[model samples]
Target: MSLRIDNQTCYFDTDTLHERLPANTVTVITDSDKPMSAVEVAGQRIHITEAQAGALTVAGATAGRRYLRATDGDSVI
Candidate 1:
């Protein structure tokens, strides 16, 4: 998925992003290779599908959800 944060844009693979997330939280697992890629959109932390990611990449932004940066406070841009 492509997300805009702090005036910069970053793209992440939906699968890789979710694989490191905890069961019911936006926080990622400690062993995540790229923890700085985790994001929450419309309060959704782990259920985003590949199709949705593709759609977001095409449209830039969804109807009501705005892309937030990685919870780690690091800039991927």
Candidate 2:
């Protein structure tokens, strides 16, 4: 998968299900057969998906953090 969790030791997929992200937060909308799920952030857990996993190139930012607008065609897995 191109999308992956940004971690030092552990990693996972990064998918964007929506065009806009919630305030001070991100979302993971997925549909995968694999049991893999959720992302780790600031000791908290965010959702992750297999179907949404892929390399995403940021086209622009709407809220504040980098938003995935297009795929850079780079995968972590």
Candidate 3:
């Protein structure tokens, strides 16, 4: 599945999400099953799952944060 939330420059997949970030914004997309494990390499698009997006939102992630971290969570519906 895929999603676009709040007009944030990002895309969500089943286990990963890709993003076209704005200037100066850095995102850390960690492996949901493995805590502290960052899966994205530098100079690459941000990856996040839909469930992860919700988790990030619940964990206080916003559109304008300079640094954002998200993890894969269970799907919603």
Candidate 4:
């Protein structure tokens, strides 16, 4: 998986699932921080399976905050 940050938005791309599965859980980790509410995937309350050909957008991230880690369940990629 790859993570890209733009302002307060985070874009996550992965190639693990061939089909759209149910929404998974997303955790955005920053320096010494737990998952925050502002971070989300596709604007969903939960992490939904991204389209096979598209990337997942995690919006509402804290401004000026640098994200060092992100995960979907046990699969980081």
TM-score for candidate 3, residues paired by index: 0.26
lDDT (0-100) at residue 14 of candidate 1? Answer: 53
List model 4 lDDT by residue over 1-77, tens digit each.
44554553445555542222222233432322533323244543333222311232234322323445555578663
Better of 3 and 4 by lDDT: 3
Clashes of 2: 9
Rank by TM-score, descending?
A: 3, 4, 1, 2
Lowest lDDT 10-mer window, candidate 2?
55-64
Q: After superposition, how far is residue 67 of candidate 4 from its true place, in Å?
A: 17
| lDDT of candidate 4 at residue 10, scale 0 to 100 | 48
lDDT of 2 at 3: 34
Q: Could you give candidate 1's per-residue lDDT for residues 1-77 as a string of tens digits?
A: 44322221333335345233222223221214433223463345543444544544444433333344465547573
| Best candidate, TM-score | 3
Q: Candidate 2 residues 1-77, lDDT tens each?
A: 23332321223323532122321243332223333444334444444443333321121111222333333568543
Q: Which candidate is the best by lDDT?
A: 3
* Candidates ranked by lDDT: 3, 1, 4, 2
Residues 23-52, model 3: lDDT tens digits = 224344554454332224234444454465
Candidate 3 residue 69 C-alpha distance from true site, Å: 26
- How well does candidate 3 score on lDDT at residue 26? 34
